[model samples]
Target: MKAEKKPIVSCKGITKVFGKDELAVHALRSIDLDIIEGDFATLAGPSGSGKTTLLNMIGALDHPTSGQVLIDGQPLSGMSKSQLSDLRLNKIGFIFQAYNLVPVLSARENVEFVLRLLKVEANERRTRADAALAEVGLRGLENRRPSALSGGQQQRVAIARALVARPRIVLADEPTANLDSTTTGELVDLMYRLNQESGTTFLIGTHDPRVMEHSKRHIEMTDGQIESDIRA
Candidate 1:
């Protein structure tokens, strides 16, 4: 029998509230979830259903108003701001709804941005960035700027940037939101392949059916609570 995988991230009774009583927004309410190792999971919900809020908390970009989040067995509540930053830099990769590439940089340079943040030497950064871009099927386009690339290609560059650092878990917030049906399908296949090939953990936030269909796990949220969680 195969050994059981450990949870990469675990949340307990999570609640995130913005502002104070009488003028407050409850983004998450009593959320208890775990993202297992090497899993491809999608958080499915409509707008204001708290998918992005939960993703943000899991990515360590923000803290929960109440409850505890543990990433790789380290609790977020007890960590300092700088510690959180380091955790994000070291353990997590992010692909935003809008491809967050710097317009001024070439595709290779954009992919190299993450490595540069870690103070990697210029030579090794170039090599890994090239490999990442090639892996994402953007070989000859390495020198192209974001403005010169199509939306799908731009998103590929973003994916290259995200994976170049070989993070423990990749957090995608509506990765297919900006893509067309065809591109969405293509991107989904690429992500699924990458997950299987590299055994990288993926936790995506999306309402798109196409995006959710390929995931190994599906979690639907409504009114700041999980409506259902099914693993296949």
Candidate 2:
């Protein structure tokens, strides 16, 4: 049999500078990074190290000042804003520290929102939303609103929303920042299970030791540049 090929995400000579010439703040400087599909990786850095800037570029939330970013061989520069939005909707999942759930929407509804946006059939949307909630251990609390749910449960709902579409990549920024250690561990374990079983790749940006411990590869940044990339 032929060897299995690695799916690639590459950033070539990427640079991002804010402000004008003399007062400019260089957030990322000529970053050359590659993350293969099915990889579990963490971006570890101190504040102002441009870890989030690099992630934002990868997530299509921001453009690089110079160079290029390629996802699955598609150049980001080749995409229009609408095309990027479509790509994000269909191919990327975002998990943020704040959970970002709709206050008025129930757990199931929040997950259903993404399905609806994807134009999933109404009936199938409900079914898939329920299943996604169940996968995140919120099966019995589907009717609860964000205010009624605990922080961990709310984050689980956010995770469900992210995973319901089965995106190829998950970009998580400080996802466990608000959780206790126990809940953080549970969340990490769940993500690992999903990654292993579904082959979903995770690219997490975190400063937490817990995240580093669970990551297969950890890339550390400092002063807006990659200081080291380590595989554990």
Q: How would you encode candidate 2's per-residue C-alpha lDDT over 172-232 as one tens digit per residue?
A: 9999999999999899988888888888899999988987888999999998899999888
Give all TM-scores, in the order shown.
0.97, 0.96
- What residue pairs are clashing in model 1? none
> Model 2, which residues run further than 4 Å from truth?
1-4
Evaluate residue 177 in candidate 2 and report its C-alpha lDDT on the 0 to 100 scale.
Answer: 94
For model 1, the stretches where C-alpha displacement exceeds 4 angstroms are none
Candidate that would win on TM-score: 1
* Candidate 2, run of 10 with poorest lDDT: 2-11
Error (Å) of candidate 2 at residue 60 is 0.4
Best by lDDT: 1
